[model samples]
Target: MHIQMNDIYKAFGANQVLTGVHFDLKEGEVHALMGENGAGKSTMMNILTGLHKRDSGKIVIDGEERYFDNPKEAEKHGIAFIHQELNVWPDMTVLDNLFIGKELRSPFGLLKTKEMKALAKKQFDKLAVTIPLEKEAGLCSVGEQQMIEIAKALMTNAKVIIMDEPTAALTEREIEKLFNVINALRKEGVSIVYISHRMEEIFAICDRITVMRDGKTVDTQMVSETSFDEVVRKMVGRELTDRYPERNPNIGDTILEVKNATRQGVFEDVNFSVKSGEIVGVAGLMGAGRTEIMRALFGLDQLDSGEILINGQKASIKNPFEAVKRGIGFITEDRKNEGLVLDFSIRENMALPNLTSFSKNGFIAYKTETDFVDMLIKRLRIKTESGETSAKNLSGGNQQKVVIAKWVGIGPRVLILDEPTRGVDVGAKREIYQLMNELTDRGVAIIMVSSELPEVLGMSDRILVVHEGKISGELLKNEATQEKIMTYATGGQ
Candidate 1:
């Protein structure tokens, strides 16, 4: 489908999200929508998919002006949106999720189970996905769930597909599979609106790129005509110095140590220690027990047998509260669900973990709380109208900053960051790296878990590669390379 949105304008009460934005998608072309979070990329796509009504705009589809009443209507018109957040029903079976509202039924009103399964299997095969149709959707790994979402969109026979951060959770192999499917779809005349912060993927897959900044279209150029530096400059409205900040390590004694940790069928025999003023990076594939170990360390999951030491002393942490009390803070990879409460204001989310510090005499100190929130907002460069604005309203990058700010408020001695810069733009990513450097400079130990290889190499003083729930190998900053890390991550000696 050929789609064009011209002069789009949208607002929520006082905040203007999209202002005179222009975007277009040609048939069979993968068009990249690049921008910083809160720069109106998602907002413009939401308008295109009918999730949000534009106050004023002209949506011309195939030379005819059109507007969809809702997302279902948009889908019916051959436009499918696979959001960054997978909308899978946890308890439902994969088959059920695949055919949720548009299930096939017989003339007698009975379910067409065989037909649905056959159709789902066909789609799965096309995408190189191996998830069992009978399994519960919730049991799937994040990468598997991402593939399911992609397959679901493909099942619709969509002429246009808007994929928001489609490969954020995917591993290298899975991403290759997804790229293959995308290439096949393009050959079959399916246009794609690919929205992502990953520049590598954009240049690798997209044919053209549209850059947005602060709710307006800055420029649109062919992928071959534009450079990464040029696109980034347009998106952030500034020339970013470097992708990562310089790190000068000041090593100190061990601050947190996990000795022989085991979580049964999940992860086993994990041994690692992070020293004060050091950033220890954990590298692994999506399901290599990286997140599981972090979850256990944060007391969100039980380690059947393990020892957690803080400052050379054994620590007992039975829950998140206990973990926090022990001066450990975690920024989870799944920010929407695990990191921040979506409905709460930015201030409320930031202050959630540090209530004791902001309270006095069994009463909340309003002035102190406000002051803290404001300071972090400015410090983190969080783009929001006010701290009182609901967290759900901020862009994904800003939401991540809120999560980081929340943990920073607790003043942790050992900070655990899982996918700290996932979905964050290049500019914001550098800012987060700077923040990490600042934290370590203050004698705070950090354990950073990331899927991005450059990030693992760039920010870490030491790298620990995980394979099959164990620390396969360790590499120092001067010795670690992408090839070595991958070799260790994949169970290489």
Candidate 2:
């Protein structure tokens, strides 16, 4: 089947989100939708999926016009969406979440729990995963939650599957497994609409790519005919030669040190140090204790036995408040749950950790709080309607910027970034890299944990490889290679 979206025009108040945008997906083909944050990609997709009614558009499925009033209507027509943010309840079991809206019910108005559980098992088996169906969805890791979302889509027997950043939280192994599943779906004549900021994944998995820019359809072309740089240029409206900002060579004395850091079953005996003005990239396969170490250092988790010294003086940190007081900040990987407050405004979230700076008489100084947030928004280039806008309203990239802006406003001496660019676009990633450079130039040390090898190799002054909850090896900037890092990451050291 071929799906055609023609003359799609949508508007929110005075903002014209999509101006005559168009997209197409062919049968059994992986079609990629590429654009920068707030480039109208999501708006266009929302229209197609029936989450929002289009002001003007024609959706043609195999020459027949279709208009879906709601998401259930779209799903009934074999169209399914796996949203960027995970949509599973922590309180519900995996089985319940998988069959949430489309539960199997008996004719007598009773819930058919056993049949739904059995059906969930079948889908998991097809996906080659073994998640405990009875376990709470919240207990599962982010990667597992992602897997459950995919399985939920499959339960609808969807002919057209829309995946928005499906692999953003997945490990290398999980990504491979997901790719295998996608390949299997293609063989069965299922079409895919893949939206992601990762260029490599688009080149590897997609057949055609549709580029959108500033609420307009820029171009649609085959993957084999176009280049990655050309696509990036189309999205950002500029030529980006250097994917990462040039590294600053100025290094100084160690600013933060963790000696013999241990967190029991989480990690063991970790030893590392970050120098002032240095960007230390931590690399390892998933579950290699990289995140755990950062968490412990940030006082999110208490180290079972370890010594943390800041600038040659031993420091005691019992919680995040203490960590912040000690001039340390962490930009967590799970931004939605850990790094941001969805209900709070952009300025409100920024004012959270640094409220003391804006208060003198126990009452918040709204003007001071907004001024600080405004400055950071400008410095970080965060795209928002206003500082009063809710954090949830901003795009993924902008939300990430807000998180950084909050920490930077606090003036942390040492910043810990966990997957800083996991789901952001190329333009945002480059901008963030530049921000990192600026921070380091100001003598603020940074410890970055990343799963992307190229990002680590390009931006870091040094690399630390972790394996099985241990610091397996360390490599200088010039000496580190993907192969060498992999060797150490797999316990070669």
Best by lDDT: 1
Residue runs of model 2 more than 4 Å from their true location after superposition: 105-118
Query: In model 1, which runs have C-alpha deviations exceeding 4 angstroms?
Result: none
lDDT of 2: 0.90
What are the models' TM-scores? 0.99, 0.95
Q: Residue by residue across 1-493, what tens digits does model 2's lDDT show?
A: 6899999999877677889999989999999999998888877878887898898979999899988888889899899999888888999999889988777888998899998888888888888888899999998877789999999998899999999999988877778889999999999999999999989999999999999988899999999999999999999999998898778568999999989999999789999999999999999987788888898888888988989999999999888999999999999988899999999999999999899999988988888888888999888878777898899978777888888888988888999999999878899899899989989999999999998889999999999999989999999999999999989998885
Scanning candidate 1 in windows of ten residues, the lowest lDDT window is 122-131
Report model 2's TM-score to 2 decimal places.
0.95
Scored against the true structure, residue 309 in model 1 reaches a CA lDDT of 94
lDDT of each: 0.93, 0.90
Which candidate number would show the highest TM-score if scored against the true structure?
A: 1
Give candidate 1's whole-model lDDT: 0.93
